[model samples]
Target: IPTIKLNNGREMPVEGYGCWKINYDRVWSLGSWLFNDDNRAGQVVLQAIRAGYRYIDSAYFYNVEKGVGHALRYAFRTGIVKREDMFIATKIWNNFHRRDRVVEGIRRSLRDMGLDYVDLAIIHWPMGFEDGDDVFPMYWNLSNVPREWSRNGFVETWQGMTDALDMGLAKSIGVSNFNIKQLKVLMDSSKIKPVVNQVECNPYYNQNKMLEFCQQNNIVMTAYSPLRQGYDLLDDPNLRRIARRHNKTAAQVALRWNIQRGVAVIPKSERRRRMNENINVFDFELRDDEMKAIDLLRQMPKLLTFGTTRSHPDYPFHDSY
Candidate 1:
């Protein structure tokens, strides 16, 4: 697997496995209905490791830290991937964005995941939620966050993040779902710049500007939802045609496209076959024309915007970037 060099001298795998939407409720989905593997998330983590994935992406928001931890421990115990070399990335939720609560938040994530340190610790979002025991939103609570809290909270939270890095809680600290403006704030104020920006990016929502900007600024952008879901993006005539040209799935082409652009991808898949296919993007490259054709479909609906929190002062969805 290829590695992307970050600002802090850290090398992250260009392709990572995402551990989101783990299907804890066992809802009637394709994976559960088709495979009947109830602990599909954990099972796939093990499989992903074997399939050549060195990096794993998860977050407190995903609520599957215990399961992810268990799978990782299992892999280590079985002599698959060594704990010291594996790259694990997790994040701090909005509720913990307060400067005072930042350490507490990441500590909880570490405890839940049972990890001593993560390779990367990201600020899940730019917004800061109400100071409370619960991390999830119960109702619209824009007021739960202070009016000037956005910039101030981010600064303070970043200070705590720097502290965590200093203490070796995480090897690298970064942000997710942050736009260029927020990044500018950090660039202006902090001594340690963010190494990566994890965002909703794919062929449909290519995030071309963000990718270029991060590269120019010495920040690597890790892409989540890197694989487009549904038939339109994956099964479209042009993408399908391109996939066939390379003897790859549309999903593989999409993942490869990101790596080709010097961006990292964390694609999620529960099935063993699909997991292998997702990481197999390293074997080929998309033609320039094929890449442009997929980029033309940049209008597909986004996967995770946290719309209910849009009213918050720090909500990042409204930005053009």
Candidate 2:
């Protein structure tokens, strides 16, 4: 229930639900099935909304836009919540980097979500390569870099995004997966500074320097993968011990740690009980020593550093993430 004030004069929730790995088998039965059942996906979103979650994070790359859109519509129709009460966020995929195509992509997402406008829109990734003849190319394949990269296309795409804000298509705009150098370039060239930078963050991979840079620049940082893709932070002895001392769940402890550091977090879950548990963090507070103990737990490597991707000739993180 905590909120952060954006540089654009809007308040965003400090914690929210993320739908990155949500099951999409029912909607699109494509290759490498992770999980199925769109009904369950819709229910999870509805439950999150009912549990006082005002912010929902999603992306075109996730391929579950229909389910999220359906859930939002159903929730409104059922009187669970009003449209204005929710902050719906979606991202532009890497493939749509050109100026005209970026606008077309947002229109397609608006059509898919059945919404007039999104509360915020983010460029999904810094790389802007086209997909090959294959539907989904290998992570390392970079055969088709967009021509715009040669001509500073990101600046043009950013201008289109700014136009989206002026045209009332998106209330705010930002970037994702950008390193310090790329972020600085955008900041220098952009007429409207990016209000948020979504990136991978957690106790294990705390981005102190990046967080400080964004803080100094008035860009809110939204921490994705806060639990490291459910890599057992909830069961850590240190976290459990701190949770017991504060009478809170280890998950809440992790979330509170990020919120206290002034970084927004989006922890995803399908279980209704866990969804409720994740949102119930406003009641209790973690002590200063406990917060420091959690901060000290930042020994793990970055989970989604862009350098790992094969597209970049210079992967930026050779020195640090």
Candidate 3:
């Protein structure tokens, strides 16, 4: 697989395996610990590594970092993947939004993942919750918002992330769910530019303008939620036709469309065949007409609407990207 070199000199795989709900049958809320065991998710992480996936995208908010860490070590012990060969990425959650706690959040993620460094660490979102014992403080109470509810707070958090990079905690630092304006603010105030801006992108909503902006700035725009609950992306008539032309599944066509345009995508699954299918996109290329057809798919953008924290002042989607 070819690698895209970030401004910071980090090489990220163009296609990665998303680990949002890897082991579990379905995604549960932050309150899921009361009813289920998350420890089982780690085995699936090991499974992906054994299946030849070199990049794994996860987040502390998913409650699966510890499991992911276990998988990494197991993969190493079994000689499935080396520590240096895999690109591991995780995010800092909104609960630890304070500048003082931003580095601390990455620290927690490293400890949970059982790694000294992450290939890339990102600020999960622009919003910071009221500092408290609750992980999802905003979800628990809508009034729980940070005192600095503007770009200033985001800048402060970005500084802390910069410090993490300097201290060797992460090789690269970036943001998730940030709009064009927020990205500009950070790039202006910080010494290091964000390498990528990950968002909910797929054939349904290709984010043409945002992709152009990131490309112009030399930042990679990563797509998540490429296929959601209904697998509707797998059933789209256009995607189906494209898949038939390539002898690939609709899912592979959707993923390849993003990859062909230089947008990295992380599609998640636990099944071995499904896992390998997500990364088998380098075999074919999408023509200009097919790319245009996929780009013009009716825009029902943003499948992952974080409704619980929608009221926060730093909410990213208020202005369209």
Question: Considering every candidate listed, which one attains the maximal lDDT?
Answer: 3
> Which lDDT tens digits does candidate 1 get at residues 1-321?
989899988799998988877644532232123333435567767788888888989887676677777788888888988987699998988878767687788887788767889899999888877677656534544333432434435777788898889888899999999888889987888889999999999888889889889988999998888876543678767778888898988888888888888889998887888888888887787888877787787476677877666767777778878
Could you give the candidate ranking by lDDT, starting with the highest? 3, 1, 2
**What value does the lDDT take at residue 19 in candidate 3?**
84
Q: Is candidate 1 or 3 superior in lDDT?
A: 3
Each candidate's lDDT (Cα)? Answer: 0.80, 0.78, 0.82
lDDT of 2 at 221: 93
Worst 10 residues of 3 by lDDT: 26-35
* Stretches > 4 Å off in candidate 3: 23-32, 139-144, 228-231
Cα lDDT, model 1, residue 174: 96
Give the range where candidate 1 is weakest over 10 consecutive residues by summed lDDT. Answer: 27-36
Q: Which stretch of 10 consecutive residues in model 2 shows the poorest summed lDDT?
A: 131-140
- Deviation in Å, model 3, residue 130 alpha carbon: 1.2
Instruction: Give the better candidate number (2 or 3) by lDDT.
Output: 3
Clashing pairs in 3: none
TM-score for each predicted model, relative to the true structure: 0.90, 0.90, 0.94
Q: Cα deviation in Å at residue 180, candidate 2?
A: 1.1
Steric clash pairs (candidate 1):
none
